[model samples]
Target chain A: SQTIHQWPATLVQPVGSPLSLECTVEGTSNPNLYWYRQAAGRGLQLLFYSVGIGQISSEVPQNLSASRPQDRQFILSSKKLLLSDSGFYLCATSTGTGGGQTEAFFGQGTRLTVV
Target chain B: AQSVTQLDSQVPVFEEAPVELRCNYSSSVSVYLFWYVQYPNQGLQLLLKYLSGSTLVESINGFEAEFNKSQTSFHLRKPSVHISDTAEYFCAVSDDGGFKTIFGAGTRLFVKA
Candidate 1:
């Protein structure tokens, strides 16, 4: 069975500090990876998605960026955190093929608080 | 481009009562629809999906959804909901062409005992 791991499970960052969140999937190769953020009482917002190594698509223009450094390793980074960046960040993976039909599996999200 | 709309932001029901959460999508091409449930402070879990056949799909937890092509809707329903079923439910849609999935704002299901 495939599983996704994300860390740190909870993060507290001061304003203007750097941010790095890592996601790694075991038991799967070449999977589609995605980064999403959910504000309190709001819908999940797509931040970025990667199809392959070194390939990433940004959905919203913001203070965050994503990278696929390896086939199953994805990272979300920010040079400087903003107060608006406080939210729950989720990393998810889906089977790569047959577009949109395969269900996405999610990791335990990181609750990020930018103070 | 594809989009999803979950009609209710919150649905409150008593435990063991029937419940229905409505969802609708808009897309030009063929699409796949899904319902995901998120427990408090946990990641989203796939409840059910409607891809091609039968127009109806069911989850192991007694939740089911029917895909209506003409109505462009996929509504999730459960005959009797439990207090454990109290969670946030999301409706999402993706095109058959491998595009990214777009999720609705989500509906919070509050099942009171």
Candidate 2:
């Protein structure tokens, strides 16, 4: 029962505006997508990862950008927004098939707040 | 290069008592250890994982972790803990073929009754 669907959950945006955060994974398909960021107390912070679809991988470079057009869809973009970019944005997936995906599964996060 | 070292950022314990959350890790290869739980805002759950023939790993709620590959450590215990167990315990590392997963810097279990 793989199911991850992050969304607005909570956002405020404003600093330079422009950021989209959406993650989808209903029952898995070609799973192995991640993008994490949890700053406030600090801890989780990966950035982006995908193993299919358009494929993308960036461990930390700044502005933020991730996309996996379909195949469980995963998107976390930003054209400008910065104020440290706010925090608490997560979306993970990894269950089986190919390296067993590494057993990761998360979602239910997204609390950006940049003003 | 994999690295994880959760040096206890906060722990209050009380409920039924007994609690320990400390992890340490560094890799030059062979890796795969995890313990994640973050209840307070949700997300982050797999409470147990060690990848091979159990060096002691059990989590169905009772929580238990023991994988000391010569003391690279993977501590996380709970002889009796409740109060929902509080939350915010993370300690992960991956390198058995890689998929990138290196995290630590978390440990905030505060179970009080």
How accurate locally, in lDDT, is each candidate? Answer: 0.92, 0.86
- Tens-digit lDDT track for model 2 on B12-93? 9899988889999988767778899999888888889998896998989899999998989989998999998898889988
For model 1, how does the per-residue alpha-carbon lDDT over B5-113 read when each residue is reduced to its tens digit?
A: 8999999999999999999999999998999999988899999988788998999999999999999999999999999999999999888887487889999999999
lDDT at residue B97 of model 2 (Cα atoms) = 70
- What candidate 2 gets wrong by more than 4 Å, as runs, is A1-16, A20-33, A37-49, A56-65, A68-75, A79-86, A90-97, A102-112, B1-17, B20-33, B37-48, B55-87, B90-108, B111-113
For candidate 2 chain A, the 10 contiguous residues with the lowest summed lDDT are A94-103
lDDT of 2 by residue, A28-114 (tens): 688888898988566998888888999898987889889898999999999989888898898988764445335788998989999
Question: Runs in model 1 with CA error above 4 Å?
Answer: none
How does model 1 score by TM-score?
Answer: 0.97
Top candidate, metric DockQ:
1
Residue B50, candidate 2: alpha-carbon lDDT: 90
CAPRI grade of model 2? incorrect
Q: For model 1, what share of native contacts is present?
A: 0.66
Model 2, CA-based lDDT: 0.86
